[model samples]
Target chain A: MGELEKIREARKKWQEKYEKSCTERDALFQSISGVPVKPLYTPEDAEGLDYLRDLGLPGEYPFTRGVRQNMYRGRLWTMRLFSGLGTAMDSNRRYHFLLDHGTTGLSVAFHMPTIMGVDSDNPRARGEVGRCGVAIDSLEDMEVLFDGIPLEKVSTSMTINAPAAILLALYIGVAEKQGVGPDKITGTIQNDILKEYIAQKSWIFPPEPSMRIITDILAFCSEHVPRWNTISISGYHIREAGSTAAQELAFTLADGLAYVEAGVKAGLDVDAFAPRLSFFFDAHLDFFEEIAKFRAARRIWAREMKERFKAKKTESLLLRFHTQTAGCSLTAQQPENNIVRTAFEALSGVLGGTQSLHTNSMDETLALPSEKAAQIALRTQQIIAFESGAADTIDPLAGSYYVESLTDRLEKQAYEYFERIEKLGGVVKAIERGFFQKEISDAAYRYQKEIEQKKRIIVGVNDYVVENEKVEIPVLVIDPEVERIQVARVKALREKRDNDAVKRRLEELKKAAAGSENLMAPILEASRAYATLGEIVDVLKSVFGEFKEIPVF
Target chain B: MERKVRVLVGKPGLDGHDRGAKVVASALRDAGMEVIYTGLHQTPEMIVEAAVQEDVDVVGLSILSGAHMALFPRVLELLKEKGVDDVLVTGGGIIPESDMEKLGKLGVGKLFGPGAPTGEIADYIREWFKSSSRAKG
Candidate 1:
């Protein structure tokens, strides 16, 4: 008999003997994404996995093993903390503090005003300025944000979507003042607008204009900011929006493919832009499933880039990503337990061969990470890198029977979603049809039902009873004074800067935005002339028009 | 025939974390309540207008952005100004216990935090509707 037939025969016999004596628990035996999980997985489970075709060696075509050959053995993944909070100076201080304590890279978390492309003084921005992240209104705020730190040295990642071009211009403006050229500046802009429509809901312009802005960035960055990652096509928000793992994988890759098509149609070479493209994903609580998802993501992205886009460069085919421990997985009840949760998630990211990582702080469920909690969060990553021996090898869980089988299953599920999305026109049209939104909502509701039905047990919440559990962890409170300071600063900037120059630059931007021109130059000019983010966004909003979602539940 | 408890689920401010709000909204709908969801980025004025227009009996404002202290009270004040005083004002997010108490004193109903069950939220709205003056009438 063949080896596979022998294993199947043995497995059937074992199951038959064990089934009568051992009954399964009365619970849902499924992955978090609802993929059914059997009690045992053997060699037969990985029967169809062709080693070379499905998963090549590290750093090869169809990179399911790891993107880099040596992975963490050569250089450890960048420990970037997604932080910001209050004024530019305040966030700058936090940056220095983080840098001092082993954080390798900087990920700026802009406040709602900045993210929404509004100024602090805007009435819509009231009560929200500097509440969640640092408020950057102009190049002045950006300069203060990077005051002591040199842009040429440390890599920065800005989490800005809608007004991503404006923020990128501001960063370039700051780099110029620091005597650093655009070529020398290295960073990433979360310039992903498609996901904003699908999940994050921070969109400004409608889909067409938004894609135009993104392609413009792609074209400009390929020529000038070659070292910069123009867009970090993200699945973090989609998963955080309560999408199943399959949905996150499929939707994110679909968005990536859409961007490639947009760039190609706009007369840009796929190789020139695709190499600079990056991704960001969430490392949720599902241990092996998260690992499988990451492996599958690398494989699918590699195949799609090569087969569909005909990306010739190896760098273009390789999928590089940053992973953040899921914030949605944290709990307000027994907040400290979140530390353990984050550590495990971060470990999965490492084992799955992430290029960069951000671990959530324990107190994040209740408030922003307090100083102590942020320190502990940073320490958690350090412990994993050093103490846990998790980073000693690359793609450590690549060949396990259950993991390989789950990876194949996730890959198949993602392909099924891809077909459905294609059937509904594409990602943008599917979004308009509320296809992705409805799927996510249904999955979210199902997960909630499971918890409520006592099928799933969440420690410290549904199952673990803690009577009058007093949260002892310190929560960071954003002082209301931060808003006052930011509002005053933006007002002062408008007063001090050359109004006529700002007006001329903004007019140039408005005109450029109206025509079929690369917007980066005009936007960079506006940023250099001290134009506010809100002013820039307002100009484009007038030309491109705003997007209003139909609000799917 | 009985009147279904009417609830307006509002996402105030710019924070787009609507997983909790949407889950609770559908759960309320499943529980046989009339739910009017005012979608993302609804200002206090927009929320109050929707509440009065929908004639909702309960207004649940979900603000995960730390703007709750500023947003929650403004919503209450707007509802009062609109002469829509009968509706209940309650919501959930990453609100501290101290802030919840302060909002409670200012006429906001019992506020929930993270990890709160959807069933718990539905129960709270149902109990509030049962004891409310609208139910008595």
Candidate 2:
């Protein structure tokens, strides 16, 4: 008999003997995303996987292994912890602390007022100023945010959308003040507006204008800020919003394709902007499945870019991503248990060949990470990078039969989703028709039911049976004084700055926004005049109306 | 026939973490209650007005932005000012146990935290509805 047939016969004989001798657990064996998990995988499972065709060498065409040739052997993945809270000064102190503790990059989280494009003094901003993140209303806040930290040295990732342009302009303005030009600054903006409409629900304008703004950013960044990652097409929020792994993979790639199409239609070269594009994904539970999802993501993206968009540059075809341990996986019952969950998820990201990572703190489910908890989270990554030996090799899980099989399955599932989305017109139309929203809601509800029905086990919740558990971890508390201080600072800036210059710049911005002009220049001009985020957003909102979602449950 | 338990699920403030809210809403619907979901970005005034207009017996406010302390009291005060005393205000988010107790002391119903079972929320509402004067009437 042939080797393959011999293995298949042996596997069948073993399964029959095993089944007769020992009964398996009386439960459905499946992945977190509902994919069936078989007992044993062998060479038969990887029957037709063409290693050379499907997964070439690291950094080669169809980069299913790793994006870089040497991978972490050349340089370790960046430990960029997402941190921001209270005022700019407060967050700045935390940044210095992180830097002192060996953090490689900076990630900023803006408060809701700043994120929603509202000034601290706006009535809508009441009770929310500096609550979730640092409140930056003008260039002044940005400057203070990077007070002693040099912009040229550390690459910053700002978690802001809808008002992403204004925030980017403010960062540029600050860089100029530090005598650093746009070319000298390097970082990424989560300028992914599509996911905002789909999951995050923090959208400012409708789809048409939002895409326009994104394309403008793409165009300008390709010319001026070549080192900057113009857009981090994100699947983090989609997964966080209760999407299945396949849905997150499919929808995120779909969004990336839509952005590529938008850029091409805007008359920009795909190779120019596509190379600068990046991705963000959530490293959730389901250890091997998460690894498979990452591997599949790279292969699918490279194939799509090469075949569909005709991307010529090798860089344009490469899929570089930042992974964050899933925040939704954290539990509040026994908070310390979250540390272990985050560590495992972080390990998955490492083995999946992530370029950057952010491990969630143990106290995050209750509040913003306290100082001690943030340190522990950072230490978790350090341990993985140095101690766990995960980063010692590239794509270490590449040829495993189960992993290879799962990767193929996920890639097939993602392509199927892409076809369904195409049939429904496109991503924006699908979003408008509530297709993505309904699918995610159903998945989320199903997962919840699984937990309630004892089908899935989440330790410390629903199963471990810890009654009268007292959470002893210290949670971060945002002082009420921070809001007062932020509101007063924005008010004082309004009084101190040149109001006429601000008005003139805003009017110029409105005119540029009305015309088909690249908005970065005018927005930077407004930022130079210390225009508040609310003012800049108001001007854009006048030209481009706000988006109201068709609420779906 | 007994009147269906009417619940107005309100997402107040600016944060967009609505997975919990939507799950609870669907669970309530599955539990055979009348659920009116006021989508995203509803202020306190808007939520109260919807409750009064819909004549909802319970108003469940989901605030994850840490603005619950400021928002919950505002909704309760507005409901009282509008002379809607029969309505119950309860919801869940990333609220701490201490804060939940404080809100409870402020006359709000029992608040839940993360990882809470939807069935428990439904049971809480049903039990409250049974004891509430609306059920006796």
Candidate 3:
């Protein structure tokens, strides 16, 4: 008999025997995304295997297996623990400490006030200044935040959304002050405003203007900051908001497609800005499933960029991504167990060939990670990079029948979602109708229900109950003094800065906002004048108006 | 006709972490209560104004930015000044034990922590409602 016929006969015989002999926990089994999981997989599971077309070589067309040809052998993935807390000066200390501890890249975590586009002294910003991250009020604080750090050397990623333009201006302003050219500075801005409306809820401007701002940044960054990644289209927050892996993949890629479409409509070449496009995914505890999701993400992005968007450049076709260990998966009870959970998640990111990664600290479920927990989180990445031989090979699980099946299935589901979204008139319209939000919320409710009923085990949470579990881990406390110090500094900045220059720049910004002109240059000019983040944001808000969310549930 | 239990879920201050708050709001809505969620970056005053306008029987403030010390007391004070004393002011989010005690002393209701179940939160609000003046005929 032919090999194919023999395999078919064996599979049929096995199925017949397994139907009667197989003992199972329940009737059905599936991954977190509800893709069915099989007991044992043979050649039948990996039915359609066109080696080159399905998953090209690591760096070849489609770039499915890995982004680069050499992968980790070329260089280890950047270990960037998203660290920032207290004042700019305080966070600067933490940055230096992290750098000294061998973090490959720097990621600034803006305080809640800063992220919301509010000054430290704003009444709404009271008590929140520098609580969650560094308080960046103006260019002065930005300079202090990067005091000794050279912008030309280290690749920094800023986790900012709604006011991404303002933050980018600040970064460029600081780089200029350091005598570094725009081309010399390399980094990424999480300029994904779509997810804000969909999940995170940190949105400022309404959607149309927000897309306008994104396209404007894309244009400006393409021309000026050639080396900078204009946007990090993020699924991290989507998954954190409780999206299924497929939903996270689909929604995020859909957002990327929408952004590319907007840029094209804005009269920019797709290849020019597409090469700078990057993705951010969440590495959850579903180890192999997360790996499959990552692989699927690469294949999908490569095919869609080359096919749908017709992106010509091979660089534009490459799907580079950063993975962050899931924060939502962290539990407060027996928080120490979070360390192990994070290590596993980080391994998934590394094995899945992430370009950069952020491993969450154990105590993050309670507060911002303490210094020790932050180090452990950083060490988690380092150990994966050096000790664990997981990264020694590219796409280690490439040929696994189960993994390939999961990847193929996830790819199919993602396409199905793309069709559904297209039917809804694209992402923005879908978002307006709360389609993405509804999907995430439904998934979230199901996941929560599963845990509540013990259908899912969350270690210390749903199963292996630990009563009176003392959380002895050290928690980082943002001192009341941090707020006091930050408030006074901003109040003083308002007094010392060139008020007339700030006013003129802000007025110019308002004019630019009112018009169809790109606002990046005007905002950069405002940053040069040392206008506070709140001032620039308010000037734009005066014209663009704030977004009021249509609650999904 | 029975009056529905009205809850205003407020995210006071600048914290944008509202996953827990949204989950709880959904839970309350699922539990047959009227839930009005004050979206992110709400000032304590704004939350109180929302509470007064919405005529909510309960105000659940969610603050994760470690600003509860300044925000919670302000919300409580604003509720009192608005002569809305009968309304319950409770909250959760990274609030250490000591602050929860202080907040409790300041007349805030039960403060749920990280692992606190949504069902228990719903029950607490329901129990408070049963004994509340609104529940009395």
Q: Pick the candidate with the highest lDDT.
A: 2
- Give the TM-score comparing model 2 with the true structure, all chains together: 0.99
Candidate 2, residues A457-549, lDDT tens digits: the string is 999898886899988988788998998998899899999999999999999999999999999999999989988999999999999999987
Per-residue lDDT of candidate 1, residues B1-137 (tens digit)? 66999999999999888888999999999999998898899999999998998888999989888998999999999988988888999999989999999999999998988888888888988888888899966
Which 10 residues in a row give candidate 1 chain B its minimum summed lDDT?
B128-137
Superposition error at B81 for model 2 (Å): 1.8
lDDT of each residue in A176-198, candidate 1, tens digit only? 89899999999999999999988
Look at candidate 2 and tell me the lDDT of residue A24: 82
> Which 10-residue window of candidate 1 chain A scores lowest in summed lDDT?
A20-29
A3, model 1: CA deviation in Å?
A: 1.3
User: What order do candidates take by lDDT, descending?
Assistant: 2, 1, 3
Instruction: Give candidates' CA RMSD values in order.
Output: 0.9, 0.9, 1.7
Which of the CAPRI classes, incorrect, acceptable, medium or high, describes model 2? high
lDDT of 3 by residue, A279-374 (tens): 999999889999989999998888888888899999998889999999988988889999999999999998898999999999997888888999
lDDT score for residue A347 of model 2: 97
**Which model, 1 or 3, shows the larger lDDT?**
1
